[model samples]
Every structure is written in structure tokens, then in C-alpha cells.
Target: MSDPKLQEKIIDALKTVQDPDLHKDIVSLGFVKNLNMEGGNVKFDVELTTPACPVKEQLRTECETKVKAIDGVVQVEVNMTAVVRSTEHAQPILTGVKNIIAVASGKGGVGKSTVSTNLAIALSLTGARVGLMDADIYGPSIPQMMGIPISSPKVGSENKFFPHEKYGLKVVSAAFLTKQGQPLMLRGPMLGGIIQQFLQNVEWGELDYLIIDLPPGTGDVQLTLTQKAPISGAVVVTTPQEISLIDADKGVKMFQ
Candidate 1:
């Protein structure tokens, strides 16, 4: 039997575990699940965003160390898994943005949006001129996720559109243009064209970094951006889950 105080201490220790990419505590993000105790031996799940994560071993060690440090804890077992990205999440489209960095994942609900948003905020907090593009045309959520209102951009010369501003960050997304609750009925070629226009025609002005939140999976939009623009690099986001890591590996390959 485990002491109640020991379990509380273990949980408290885990509160210090941070998802390095997302800049949020792992416990708050629901990454630490299923804490079981048996005679001072503890077993828990350390769910991650991607399985192919370079930090897997480090995180596992950190989790173990944190759990073991608690008084009365004898052993620690961390069962790792990856979280998937959800289709309902929207991808942001950036315009006139330079140094594009696509945040991608093999599966949905892996906290890709959370990573993108926090990264943009962190970059901006560092005084870099930043913009976020929601490239997930089918499901756009940058507006809501970032707490920005949905409004159409103003048209300028040559019928170019201007990006909306939020927290000193410029942003553009499908959610900003469509009517509330309307379906986006677009095919591959059409969707690609729209993303192209958002990149080429929008008045993003000058920006140091443009972070793109890509939709889950390998699709036309992702290919279009890679081929159409000069991307600096790609960041793969995944939970420590096997299935998510398997898919994230494919995403890394797609970029390579």
C-alpha cells in the first residue's frame, strides 16, 4: 500500500514536467495519465505528442527521476504513448511572410496548434516580428485558438488582402473569411491555389518569421507550400505515442 502523502508528492513533482515545445506543464496538458501505486512501486503513463520525438529518452528519464524523488516511492514505470492531432483544428495561412516554418504532425490532436501558438508568442516575446498562417484550409481554428475575432481582411491595390493583427502578431486564416458555420468545399487543386494566394497576394508586409500551422497528414497544401515557397525548416510535433510517432516519421520524410 502506498501512502496518500507519497502519491500527492509524486503528482506535485510531475507538475514541474514541462512539454519543452509547447511551453506548458505536462500535467496541465493532460500528458501524464493513469497513476497506479502498488506497495511503493508506481506505474504511470507519460503521453507525448510524438513518438519519433528526439527528446523521448530525456523526457522518460526526467519523469522517472521526478517520480522517484518522492519519499516512500520505490520504483517508477512510465508507459509512453503519442497523442493525435484532431481534424477539427484549423491550419493558419500566412501572407507576405518570410522564413516560413511549418509545424506539422502525422496524426491529429497532438497539440500542434498549441505548439504553434505558443511558439509564435515566444518568438514575439523575444521582439521578433512574427506572423502565424493557418494553412489547414478545411478546418481553420487559428482565430478561435488565438482568441482573435473572425473578420475579413481589407482589400488593397491589385486586390491584395491584409492580414489581421493579434498580440503584435499578424495572422490570416480560412476562419476569418468564411461565414459562421459554413462548410469549406474545396478540392486539392483549389485548396492549393488558395494557399498560394494567401502567401503571394496578402500584404504581410515585413516579418522576421512566419510560422505555419499545417493540417494533419500529408496533403496537397503541405506539398504546395514546400514547392512554392522558400521554407527555412520544418518542425514535427507529436505525442510520445507509437502511432503518432509512426506518422510523424512519415511527415519528417515528406519534408526531407
Candidate 2:
């Protein structure tokens, strides 16, 4: 005879499990799908928001542990799958890119680019395909920090510029085209045009994460990128200061 009471116990256990990102129990969020219990073996599948989720393994382990603690449950099985969601403004050029994360700051000299560079390196170290785009046209520094040979992007078919590769990262920076310490001298419209080319013309194939180091402050480049690119999210870097906090608030509001 089947024990209906045991099924309730299994579900109750799952209710206690929460996703770190969503901060809600997986069961209530409808992540625990197609659950079935046969004898003492409980089997189910977990559909994550994205395959690039950093804590996917942790969630799976928690689910297994919670369900296996049930008195009558002997074996627990979980199948993992990912469904990547897209923004309404997603562009075709970024079709293969799984996630576009922009690192910005309220003002300059706040180490925004440094944070973006190191974050990309850290993600690459984890065996993920990572790319870094220095969106700071007037003061692009990723080329120097990454030690990439100063060279122009090579043109691929369909007028796409191939991204420069270094340290297992695909990188694109305006510094590659202009000499060190040279000024861009471009107006706002021109700056927006350049940023668009970087997004639409760069051949960044199938990256797990594209880390964009946006120029500090809420400016033309930031506004252009936000409007033209399907940015999955933003990271605002700010030091402990009153002025920086105020500027950081503007950055946050721009996204909202």
C-alpha cells in the first residue's frame, strides 16, 4: 500500500529549502517539478533560472539532504536543468551570450574597472567562458591591466571585430585602437555610436558571462549601453563616502 502521508512529509521538507539568489523556498517558487515517489525512492527535477548560476550545486545538495532526512525516504534523485530568461530589449548579436553583467560606479576613480577585471578573472578561473569589455572609451585601461598586446581588432566576415584574447578571457577595449594617454575627443553621439559598435560588431562567441566595465557615473555611455544592450544586471561599486553614495543612488535609479 502507498503511504499518502509520506508524500506530504517529502513536500514539507522541500518547503524548508530556499534558493540563495531568489531567497524563497524552492517548492513555493515552483522549482521542484515533476516530483514522484515510488517505494522509498523519491525522484524530482530542479529547473534553475540559469545554467550559469553559481550556487546550483549547493541548492541541489540541500534538496537532497532535506528529502533524504524523511523517515521513509531511502533514496533521493534530482535532475538539474536550466532555462535562461532574456530581457525585452535583447539583441540578436548577443544571442549566444548567456549573461551580460555590467560593473559600474557612481563616479570615477572608484576602482570600477578593477572590480570588473578581477571579477572576470575570478569567473574564468572557475572554468567558465568569460569576456571583459572596457566600456570606458575615454579611459580604457583593461588592455594595460590584462597585458594584451596593443592592437586593433581583426575584422571577421560580416564586418564583426574579433575580440582580443588573453588569460583565457575574450577582451575588447578602446585602448586597443588609440595610443596610451590619448584623448577620445568624441562627442556624446559619437560615444554612443562607438559603444553600439562594440556590442553589435564584436565577435564574442558564446560567452558564459560578458563583464562590461562601464565608465563611472551616470553618463552618456552608461545610458546608451543600458538602452541598446540587454544587460542582465548591474553591479554598483562605491567607496565609503557621502558623495559616492549619492552618485551610486543615481546609478541604481537609472536601471530602475
Candidate 3:
């Protein structure tokens, strides 16, 4: 037989569970729903903001831990569900993407592209659907580092391009579109247009993380991406030198 007072203790326990992404407790966020208990058995559902949430497992574990800590709890079941929340400026081209993270650096020598490529690959290794876009039109190096042969993207319906794959990471880069050793000789407007096409015309389907490697320093390409795309966050890579820190500050401010 279940004591009515145990339900109060269970509810109190759930209040301690937090959803890191939402920055709120699961109970306060209304995630602790359909809670039913009989004897020492308890079950409930934790609805998340997205199916591809990076921290979904963490939240689930915390919820179970909190409930199982209740004095009368013998069995705990946590059901998970997702209802993806859309941004106000969400575009049709990025419908399937759950999150976008831009990797930038203060200067060219910094390992921004290397970090971007490996981050995408690491995420993919974790069973996440990941995509990497080389926004460094003038010095795209992801294809070379990933050892993907230079080739153009295939066109699909509505003229969208399908991204290339290497090591389970989906990739799109200006290097693939340009001839070897050819410089991207163009003005700011032309460069912006090309960046737009790279983002909007690529058929990136159902990705957990879309990592964009921006060109070194904050310039026309960076401006175009920040203004035109729905960037969720930015990762500024910098060296220990004061100069690098100074420029990295600028990159951070640009995103802010």
C-alpha cells in the first residue's frame, strides 16, 4: 500500500532535478508530468525542449536519481519526450538543424579550423548527427585535414546541395567548389553572397549539431554569417599571447 505522504516527498524530490539547457528545475519547468505511484513503484515523463538535446541523458539520470532517493521509492521509471522549440528567426533552410555553433579565432595561425573539424567528428562519435561547414572561403582547410578529395556537392531537389561525408561527419567547404590553389578574388558583397549560398543552399538534413568554422579575424564573412544566419553560439579560439586575446575579445563582442 502507498502512503499519500510519500507522493508529497516524491514531488519534493523532483524539485531538485535541473534541466541545464533550460536553466530551470524539472518540476518548475513542468517536465514532471503523468507521475503515478503504487506501493514503492514510481513513473513519470520528462518532456525536453528537443529530441536532439545535447544534455537529454544527463537530465534523465538526474530525474531518476532524485526520485529514487525518496524514502518509499523502490522502482523509478523516467519516460522522455521531445518537442523542439523554434527560434523567432528560424529559416526553412535550417529546419532540421537543432543547434548551430560557430568556431572563430583571433588570427589565421590559431587552430580554429582544426578544432571545428575535430569537434564535429567528436560529436558524431558520440552518436550525434553532426555537420561541419567551412565558412573560411579564402582558406578552407577542413576538406584537406579530413582527407576528403576535392569535389563539388551533388544537387538535389530545389537546387540544394548534398554535403560530403568523411569519418561520419557531413562537410561543406569552399575548398570543394574552387580549383586547387585558386584564390577567392572577390569584394565584400560577392563574398557575402557566397557565404549565404553555403548556408541556405546546402541540404543539411536532421543534424544534432551544425559547426561552422569561420575565417580568421572578424571581417565581411563573419559579419554576413552573424547577421544572416541563426547562430546559437560561438566558440572563440585564441592563443596565450596578448595580441591574440585582444582580437579574440573583438570576435566575442561581434557575436554579443
Candidate 4:
């Protein structure tokens, strides 16, 4: 026979464990799923919002430790899984993308693209589906950095572009669309149009996060993204130098 009172004790014990990010217990956040109890053997799954959560193992360990300490509990099994959540009721403009993170800089030479590249890769290492979009039209460097050949993305039906696949990431950049060493004498409106094309017409498929490497400084690409897309967050890259810090300040305020 199942002991309802014992199960209640297990739940209460779990309630003591709180999600550091959500500032609430997992039970209150509806993270505990598929809980099963058989005599003293207890098993359950903890579903997190993002696979890239920094404290994933910590939560799993806490769940196991707490449940095992309960009286009459012989074994405790906790499975960790993730389902990336969107920002509130905001429907993503990118069909299957759950979150869009923009990486920008106040000026050039601050390594914004490099930081963005590593950020996408780090997220992918955590088992999250990640994509990188190089929005730096004038000097697209992600292709060279990522070793992606300068070639246009493959087109699908309805004029949708299939982003280039490289290093477990779906990548897209203007370098693929233009000739090598070609000077793009594009105006502000044209720049905005290009960004919109990349955002709406790319077949990014299902992604937990899409990292956009914006051009150095606030420009057409930044304006288009901020005005059109629901950006979840922004990162400003800069150097320790005062000049770099000054530009980075502008980038931060632009996003804010």
C-alpha cells in the first residue's frame, strides 16, 4: 500500500529546496514532474527552463540528497531535463527560437564577435540547441572565425534560407551573400532591410537560443532588431580602456 503521508513528507522536504534563479521552490514553479513512489523507492524528474542553466547539477544533487534523508526512503532517483521557456507571453518572431540574445559593442576591436561565438558554443555544450547570426554587415567575420565557407545559405520553399550548419550550430551572415573583399556601399534603410531578411527568412529550425553578433556601435542593424524583434537580453563587449568603456556605455544604453 502507498503511504500518502510519507509522500507528503517527501514533498515538504523538496519544498525546502529552492531554485536560485526563480527565487522559489521547484514544487511551486511546477518543475517536479512524473513523481513516483514505491514503498521506500522514490523517483522523479526535475524539468528546468533552460539546458544551459548553470546550477543544473546542483539542483539534481540537492533533490537526491533531500529525498534520501527522509525516513523509510531507501532509494531516490532524480532525472534532469530541460524545456526552454519564452519570455512571458511574448511570441517569438523567429518561428522555433525560444530566446534571442544580442551581443553588441560600442566600438570596433573590442572582440564582440569572438565573445558572441563563444557564448553560442558554450550554450550548445550544455545540450541546448543554439544558433549564431552575424549581423555585422560591413565586416562579417563569423564565417572566417567559424571556418564557414563564404557561400550563400541554401534556399528552401517560400524563399526561406537554410542557415549553414557548423560546429553544432546553425550560422548565418552577410559574408555568405556578398563577394569576398566587396565593399558594401549600402545605406541605412538597406542595412535595416538586410537584417530583417536574416531574421524572418532564415530556417533556423528549433533553437533554445539565437545569438546575434551585432556590428560595432549602434547602427541600422541594432535599430532594426530592437524595433522589430523581442530581444530577451543583450551583452555589451568592451575593453578595460576608458575609450572602450565609453563606447560600451553607449551600447548598453542603446539596448536599455
- Full candidate order by TM-score, most accurate first: 4, 3, 2, 1
Question: Which residue pairs clash in candidate 4?
Answer: none
Candidates' TM-scores?
0.62, 0.76, 0.80, 0.95
- Cand. 2 Cα-lDDT: 0.87
- lDDT digits (tens) for residues 157-225 of candidate 1: 999988888899989898877887787888788988988887888888877678899999999998998
Q: What lDDT tens digits, residue by residue, belong to model 4 across residues 153-230?
A: 789999998999988999999898888777677988999999998889999889889999999988888999999888
Candidate 4 has a TM-score of 0.95
Local error of candidate 2 at residue 237 (angstroms) = 1.8
Model 3: per-residue Cα lDDT over 187-256, one tens digit each: 7788899888988899988887899999998899999988888888899999999988999999999999
Evaluate model 3: give its lDDT: 0.85
User: Judged by lDDT, which candidate is best?
Assistant: 4
TM-score of 2: 0.76
Each model's number of backbone clashes?
A: 31, 0, 0, 0
**Overall lDDT per candidate, in order of appearance:** 0.82, 0.87, 0.85, 0.91
Model 4 regions lying over 4 Å from their true place: 89-92
Model 1 scores a TM of: 0.62
